[model samples]
Target: MGAAWETSRRTVLRGGVALAALAATAGTAFAKPAGRRLPFLLDMVQNNPGEPLFSSRFNDPATLKSYGYDGQVINEFIPPQTAITFDSFDQRIFPAGSEGRAWVEAAAKKIDAHIARAHAAGIAAYIFTDIIVLPKRLVELYGEQILDSKGRISFDRPLTQQIHRLMLSEICARFPGLDGIVVRTGETYVQNVPFHTGNNPITNGAASHLTLLGILRDEMCVRANKRVFYRTWSTGSDKLTSDPDFYRQVTDQVETHEKLVFSIKHTEKDFWRTIPFNRTIGVGKHRQIIEVECQREYEGKGAFPNYVIDGVVNGFEEFRTPSRTGPIGLAEVVDNPIIAGIWTWSRGGGWRGPYLQNELWCDLNTWVIARWTRDTSLGEEGAFTEYATTRLGLRGEQVRRFRRLALLSAAAVLRGHYSVVHPMGRLMWTRDQFLGGSDKDLTSDYAAIVAKGRVEPVLAEKALAARMWDEIVALSGTIPLRDHADRTYLRVSARYGQSWHRVVHHGWEVMLRGYAGDQNGRYDKAAMRYHLARYDAEWQRWQRLAKTEPSCATLYQPYSFGPKGPDGLYNADPDHGIKPATDHYRKLLSS
Candidate 1:
């Protein structure tokens, strides 16, 4: 790998300009209303779900400016799963041998152009480091000794480690204009790996792998005068507890590096509701950034607006120093204080694609984050009103009604549905965990119980789903959407919401016999017929909706690996939504 160009006179002048720009924003970045002037880094990753990759609008400098992102990490640049594979268009920095030299060099030139544009717009450019584990090519080229029998990364071997260093150093050397790298060791997203295998250095521990990689990245970045961001994602065995002491120990080990910054999600878990603040922020001594996902990828798949004004505001509040008088923002008051910035994910995490189909919700939410981080005194309600009025062009009453709908939707998803869901039972609503007992077993168990007699709890869950769906339908009708696309999203969402309840209702019906046991002498014929009919009708509706609104499938049911099942008409569960329904059919037929 090589730098794209020699230091020319234009390059020198550009560097001077960049430095001056940094100096100009230094005070604002540091003070941020509360008043201490440390560097406030607001980095955003370009992973908006359903967003067309490499599209003109997405790559335009003006569009980046509109979002108010200080720095942008171009995601999937390294092709996380198939890094070793060669794609003519995909940007890759690995496979540094001569085989990849020309391709890497060509990609470098393109990357340099992007970096220059980003810098021109006053936005730092960084590539997301997705070296979850050794790709199949590396293991095959070197030897099988790279991994153990269980496919766990075997750190005892030196081959993979050598390749890892080569990849990191090559990428840094080649992309000299890049601000730094963002490392995610927890979620490799490598295909067929059961999703969360936590691939890293498996010998010492998860923490060891994280530190070693951080040290390597730091050395490379320090030499190149770049920065390295190590995310405290707690992937693999590096599972952290609520105890601050545990994070303290981990932070003590890695935070000592000067150029390395620790990035953590606002909550301990993957951008989910009800997850408490990650106390680790209170323990770190180095520069840190709190990662917030603007699009509700899984919670609602961006079909409807899922407001998180409270969640984001609460997160900053948790980290503020106690007893701070006057307008205290994060900068002014911090107890264990070296927090330097905020990292927000606009899209591209989870099983789905982009969060907002209409772009209204996405743009507003991203704007709120960028503005609020700069001025913590800005009240959430005031911010929403300003956004609705200014950005959305909504008047007084329209603004209030819009706000009401957003909050109500949030409550329905987070409190109404998510709260009642058994922790292990995700109902295909989450991407952070594998589909297991709570997802697959519960439905069958309920069917068995229903066989004997009606179960009060199952019936109650069904009613709750129906109520939520009805409320969603009612609210959707009241909100006026002029845009055809926006209106289409509402229609599909109402239908999907309704279908979800039916899925649950039918699932409960199918599980009845299992719970009834010996008392299942008589089969309830009517319930079975009604369940099948409802199930078929929902799928048929999805088909019709897909034809009318092509983006509906991706917008409504975007999964990690594309829209699941035929025409994106699958049930909410995994392996296609129809599996559970069909499995129930077999059970009923035999009976």
Candidate 2:
């Protein structure tokens, strides 16, 4: 039965590829072809329960085609069990009469319908799944065999391999329409899947990763004739994802095949500014896809204007150094044949809550990147102009003015959120959906800045960011857009950004003064009090704007300096060594 299925799947894949190529040839004659240099322009969409439009807009076929994306990655946390059929081996893991089993069966049908829609639209669909996810009952039945001496889930264990093979085979058989499987090996979240648990299967590092990749390459690529988009995101678990040399070490060991492609983020690390470009891209023999996050979770989550086109298409000027190799931006690699695609995360990254009512910011970045990927000649400014003229109906000076506003907004974000003078060394002041100004993260960052005697410069940068935001607000009002609602949104969002940057500036000032006073042994009570008052006033003003403007993103509490904050960065009283001023500020708030 398995042999016959494999034979039939190979035949279908050949026919599908040939038909797709012919269709592409025919379609290109009429319209500009997409994925010219980068053959796979894909975007991933996950469910945002709070924002239904987030997923719906991205998943819409018209939206995908309009954006020039030839493929879509459905990574809505759809578990492997959803596609796996129950057999004797599976029954042992997920015994009959289990609620999870029933749920999986129903979810599979929904997934089938979703894939069919993608196929109907001529968009290739790939399902995303974490490796080594199994029913909780599997541990109860086979814990000893599954676990290593250190109690970590062992990937090399016979039982684990057997289950991995079974899951891959079942998914391929059940969903023959799937073009590939996107494998994330770094982290696993079993919180949503009550009945299932997952862990990184490559516990033993490169060798183990090699073993797993070999299995996937053979099973998915060779047998099933499907692609395997092996994501090189290890979340800092070894240098497999970040270090170019380390990445090559692991990938070079694997036998290269046309069906096996490496998906890497544009940054060497997770999506953040100030990090160098991922040098692993265009390296080695395997095809590669550069991952870009349009919404920018760490920056603003599309809550404010945080344009990334200039930085992404042209290397960020901030991070450029003399010793860098190859090109720092995606546009530079357009001619590289090994660079096969661009994968975009239009929305959804980091934790929730600066939920957006207006996707204008996200849409701007997504549309430009998508269009540029199709035609590399668009560049950054060209693409922005096109978007302005074609989408926003701006012409002449209006387009130029909007571009200036966007550039200023992007600059403001970098200065406000990151250290402009210093190489952002391990200081996470803001992340994902939340901004922390008075927290220990910022405190530590300020302490380092103060110690380096760069406090004044940092403050100057912050003030400049605040001023640029003011300019952004002013410029936004002058540019009369075709869409009045969009114009209002840009104006209001810029106002919110102005207020937010003021809060950041004042918040950092408070921390810098506290740290500098502690270092110099001369505490300035008057300065501290003034900055604290300013911070509070700005935060309140930002909150008021947030309440009035629907497009304004939800604000993060800037002064929540309590015990047990994110990553234990605030275990100690954040107000503790920087006292009297903070104490007075706390009292003022309480009163």
lDDT of 1 by residue, 1-591 (tens): 112112222343344343334223321222323423235545444442222452323355556666555677666434322222322222342444545454445555666776898889887877676554544444544557567767666655665565556656656655667777777664554332211123655346545555465555555655666777777675545654334576666666653556677787776666666555666664556677777776655565454456665446533322233553332233333323566666766554564332334454555566676666555555455566767666656676766656655654554454333443233234333332111122244444444434433354444445454455555676667666556566566656665556545554554444442234324465445555555566566656655755676545342331112244442222344443334434555466566
lDDT of each: 0.52, 0.72
Q: What is candidate 1's CA lDDT for residue 42?
A: 52
Q: Clashes in model 2: which pairs? A: none
Q: TM-score for each prediction?
A: 0.71, 0.87
Best by TM-score: 2
Where model 1 places Cα greater than 4 Å from the true spot, the runs are 1-61, 77-99, 132-167, 189-199, 210-214, 240-243, 255-258, 315-336, 352-357, 415-417, 421-458, 480-495, 498-502, 505-532, 555-579, 582-591
Task: Name the regions of candidate 2 deviating beyond 4 angstroms.
Answer: 1-36, 47-56, 320-326, 437-439, 559-591
lDDT of 2: 0.72
- lDDT string for model 2 (245-345, tens) is 88888888998899999999999888888888888888888899889998876787877888887788777756455676667787667677988888998
Evaluated at residue 238, the lDDT of candidate 1 is 65
Tell me the lDDT of model 1 at 512.
Answer: 45
